[model samples]
Target chain A: MKKIKYILLATIIATIWGCKPEEFGPIVGSEENFLKEMQGTWSLTKVTQVDQNAVSNGWPYKQLDITNIYPYKELVVSFQGDASGKPSTFTITPGNSPKIADLNSGNWSVDNTKAPTVITLTNNGQTSTLTLGSYANLKNGKFYLKREKKVNGKTILVYQYEFTKK
Target chain B: MKKLILSIIFILSATLAFAQVTLSPATFTAEDEVTITLDVTGTPLAGTQDVYIWIFSNSDLPAEIIKKDGLTNGQWTNSADAAKMTKTGTNIFTFKFTGTTLFGQSPAELINFGFLAKTKDGTKQTQDYKPYKFDPLVFVPMQFRVFPSKMDQTDMTTVYFHQDLATDQNLQRMFDVKVNLVFYNDATPVPAVVATRTALVTVKESNILYSYSFIPERLITLTAGTKLTKFTYQFTGSVKDANGANVPVAGPVTEVVYTPFN
Candidate 1:
C-alpha cells in the first residue's frame, strides 16, 4: 500500500510539471505606449516647404523655412484616445490659418504598432497619409510630420509640420 | 600719315565712349535702386568740388531737352542735397537713385531717361546728355528664367524652363529632361568653383513649364568666407539618332549672377 501511494504521488507531480507552459521575456507593448504618449494637445511651431524635384536631384537645399510666413502658430491639434488607450479621433483647430491637414477632424491610425513611420487620417472615406519624421521620440514633447502634395500620382511638393506638446 | 590720323581719331572716340556715365546694374527695371557712376576726366565737370545730377525724362517729352516736371532734385541752377554726387575716386563720382522715386511716376509711366553731371551752380557740365532705357516692367515669359531676379547665397532660388518659349525644335519636344549646374564663388580675386553636378530632376509645373529650385549654401559646401557669386546651368535631354538610338543633347548654357545680401 505504501509503494502504491508513492507511485501515484510521483505520477501526479510529473503530470503537473509536463502541463506547465514555457515562459519568455515580458511583452514590449510599444504600440500602447506610443498611443498613450500621443494622446494630448499639440501646438504648431514651424512649417517648411520642400521642393521634391530638388530633393530627388540630391540638391543641398530642398526645403524653404516658412514658419513665420503664415499664421501657423495659431493652429492647434489634438489626438484623442479611446478607453483602451488606442489611437482614435484627431482634430485640428486652424485659427486664421489654412487647414494644412485638409480635414478638420478624422479617424487616425498608424501603419504599424511596433514601428510607426506613417500616420493616416480618414474622413468620410477620404484618407490622407503623413510620413512621420525620423526624429519622433514621443516622450521628447516634439513631433514632426511630412505631407506630400501630389498631382496625378506624382509627388510635386512636400510640406513639413513641426508641433510642440502643449 | 592720313591713315595714322584716322587711327588716332578712332582711339580718341573709343576713349570718350569708355569715359561716359555708366550704370551699376546694366539692366534694371524702374523699381530698382540704381547707382550711376560718371568718369568726368575729359568732361567740363571734372575737378569740380561739388558735383550735382540733372536727370530728365527723355521719353515723355521727346521734343524737349530739359523737362524737369517730375524731377526729385532741386532746380538745375540750385541742385538739391539728394542730387549731390559722392566722389568715389579721382575723377569718378556716383549718384544713387530709384527711377520710380526720382521721377515720382509709376514703372509703367517711365521708359527712357537722360542724365548729366554738372557743377553745383550748373555753369560747368558734361558736354552731352547720357541716355538709358529701362527694362520692361511687364512679365514676358522666356525660354529660361530665374525667380526673384535677385538672389543671395542663403536664399532659395528657382530656375525655370518654358517649353513654349523654346526656340529649338528638339527642346520643345524633349522628354525626361534634367538640369546640369555648376557654382562659382567669384567674390574673391580668384574664383572658387564647385564640381559640376548633372542629373538634377525638374518638377513639372504645367504642360509646358518646369522648374528646379535650390539653395546655394545647401547644395554646395562653401569653404570659409566663400560667397556664391554666380552659377551656370543647362538643360539636357536625349534625342533619337539616325539609327533610332537615343543620343544626349543639351540646351544653351545659361549663367546667372547673385546679388549680395545686405
Candidate 2:
C-alpha cells in the first residue's frame, strides 16, 4: 500500500509538471531574425474561392502579398497588386495618419510555437482583429505565413507564405 | 451497488449537459404588411415554466407591459387593447403590424423593434435582433385640408394646413412638416410663394385656437414678381406614442389663395 501511494504521488507530480501551460516570453527578436522569419515577401500562389457546390470555403482566399517594411516598432501593409494578382507590403507602425490614405496602424501580438505559430493584429480602435499563422522548416531554410485557407467540406488549411532568411 | 451508482451519476451528468432551450426560427422577416411568428420551447422544462413575450418598437431593451392575464398587479396589462401584445401562447407569439403603421409612409424609414421573454421566476430577457426598417414606397394617394377661408392680405398669409392621420393611429404629440406649393399666373402655373411657415394649433377650453408655429422657412426659392394662382403643399411628419406607434393626423391638403383686388 505504501508503494502504491508513492507511485500515485509521483504520477500526480508528473501530470502537474507536464500540464503546465506554455509561456511565450515578451516580444524579443532581432530585426534580422524577424526578416528571416517574415521577409522575402509572399504572394498568393494558390486560390480556391469556393468549394464544389460554390459554397464559401470559410477562408479569406483573396490574393494579397505581404511585404515586411520598417523595423520592430512599426509595420505597414500596402495593398498594391491588381484585383486578382497583386503585391502588397505590411509595415509596422505606432499610429494611424489623419489623411487615412498614407498609413494604417494597430496593436499586434505574436506567438511562437510548433509548426504553426500565430500573430494576432487588431485595428480600427479594436473593432477588427485578424490572426495570421506562420510555418517554418529550418532544415530547408524555408519559412512561410498563411495568407489564405484551403477548404474541404468543413476542414480548412489556410494559405501560407514562403520565405528565406536574409 | 457501486457500479449502479456510477451508472446513475453518468446518466445524470449527460442529461444536464444536453439540457438547453431550443428557439425555433431564430430569425424573422415581416414582409411589408405581414405578421411574424416566433415559436419557442424549453428543451427540459417546457410545461413547468411559462414564457411571456413582449414586443417593443424602436427599442432593443426589455420593457414590461401591465399584466392582464391576472398575473400581477400594477404591471402593464397585456390586454386586447394593447397593439403590441397580440396572440400570446404557451410557447408561441405573433406580432402583426402594417408597414405604414410601424413606420410612417416615407422613403428609407428605419424603425427599431425588439422582442422579450419572461420566465416563471420573473427572469426577463430581451432580443437584439437587427432593427427593422421600411423602404420608401411609391407615392401613396393622400389628401389634406386647410382651415379658415378668409385670407388677411395685411398680415403675410398664415395658412392652417391639416391632414387626417393614417389609419394606424399611433402618433406621439410631436410632428414635422414638408410642403410643395405651385402658384399660377392668370391660368398658367407660376411660382409666387418665396417663403413658407408652419405651426401646431391647440384649442383651449375657452374655444380659442392657439397657434404654436414652428420656424418659418423657405422650402423652395422663387424670383420676385412670380404670379400667384394655386398652391400645392405636401407635409410629412411623425408623432410617436408611449408605445412608439405613430399617431395619425387628420384632414385634406390645406390650401390658401391670393384673390387679386379689382
Candidate 3:
C-alpha cells in the first residue's frame, strides 16, 4: 500500500510537470554535425563586409551589389569531398579588374566551431580568409561571407558573397 | 481557516469595488509574461502627473487593504515601491512583467495579485482587480516559417506557431482554453504534426509566446524527389465552461497558407 502510494504521488508530480507549455522547440541537428554538412559546393549568394574602424569614425559601411559586380557573375567555387575534405578550386572568368586576371585554384576549409566561423581559402599562392555566421546560417540555403582590407590607408569593407548549396 | 477563506472570498467580491481596473490574461505561469494595463481613460488620471501602478502579492498587503483592494476605483496606496509600471497606450498605464522573474526561485503555484494605481500624492486612483483563476481561457498562435519556404525533398523547412495568451477580456471569463493545430500540404493527407518525428519543444525566446514547430520533408517523401509546391494550416481553439464542457470560440475557419518563397 505504501509503495502504491509513493508511485501514485510520483505519477501525479510527473503529470503536473508535463502540463506546462514549452516556449521553444528543439531545432533538429543544429551545430552538431559540422564537418559532415560541409560536403557540397556552395555558391556565393549574398555578402556584406564592413570596416569597424570606419564605422566608429561615423562613416557608413559600403554594401556591394553582387548582381552588378562583373567578376562575381562568372565565379564558381567548388568544394570537394576528397581525402583532405577541403575546397578544391575557385574558377572565375576574368572581368574588368586586373586582380581577377591572375587568380588561381585554392584549398578551403571552414572552422565552423569558432565564434564567427572562419572561411580560409588559398588562391594564387596567397591565402585569404573571411568569417561566416554559423553552419545554420550556411544551411539556410545561402552563403554569406565578408572581409575588411585597407586601401591607401583608408579602411574599407570588401563585402557580400553569399551562397546557397545546390 | 474557514473564516479566513470566507473573508478572502468576500474581499474579491464585486461589492467593495470602486473604479474599474482589469488585468487582461491574468492566468500566467512562471514561464509567462503578462501585459497588465491600467485603463484610466475617463477619470482624473487622464493627465499624466506622476500617477503610477505597482503590483504585489496578496500576502504583502494589509488585511484591511487586501479586503478593499478589490474595490473598483478604490483609493489605494502601495505598501511596496518595487516596480514602476510604464505608460503605454493613450490614457493607459501598461507594463509587461515576467512571471518567473517576479516570483523568483521559490514561487507559489498561483500568484494572487494586489495592485495599486494611484498618483504619488494619493490623489487619483483606480480599484484593485484580483484574478478569478490561473489557467487562461484563450491561446493565440503566432506563426512564422524558415527563409527558403520552398526546398528540395531532402532539405528541411520549419513551420512554427507560437502559442500566446489573448489579451482580450471576452476570452478571459471562460476556462480551460486550449488549441489544436493541423498542418497539411496542398493535395495530400500527410500530417505535418506527427509525434514520432516531431522536434521536442522546450523553451521560448521571449516569455510572451509558447512555440511549436514542424518539418515538411518528414511528412511525405517523393520517390523521384518531386518538388511539392504549397502547404497550409488550420487551427481551432476552445474554452471550457462551468460544467467542464468545451465551448468553441467563433472565428472564420480559414486555412492560412504559407507565403511563397522569397
Maximum-lDDT candidate: 1
Docking class of 1: incorrect
| Candidate numbers, best TM-score first, in rank order | 1, 3, 2
Pitting candidate 2 against candidate 3, the one with the higher TM-score is 3
Per-residue C-alpha lDDT of model 3 across residues A58-166, encoded as one tens digit per residue? 4332232334323344444555545544344544333332122223456665664323367677775777666555456655665555553443344333444656776
- The alpha-carbon deviation from the true structure for residue B71 of candidate 2, after best TM-score superposition, in angstroms, is 26
What root-mean-square deviation over C-alphas does model 1 reach?
21.3
Judged by whole-model lDDT over C-alpha atoms, candidate 1 comes out at: 0.75
Q: Which residue runs does candidate 3 get wrong by more than 4 Å? A: A1-37, A41-166, B1-27, B58-82, B103-108, B111-114, B132-262
- Looking at model 3 chain A, which ten-residue stretch has the lowest summed lDDT? A93-102
TM-score of each: 0.51, 0.21, 0.31
Candidate 2 runs further than 4 Å off: A1-35, A48-108, A112-116, A127-134, A137-143, A146-166, B1-262
Give the better candidate number (1 or 2) by lDDT: 1
Worst 10 residues of 1 chain B by lDDT: B61-70
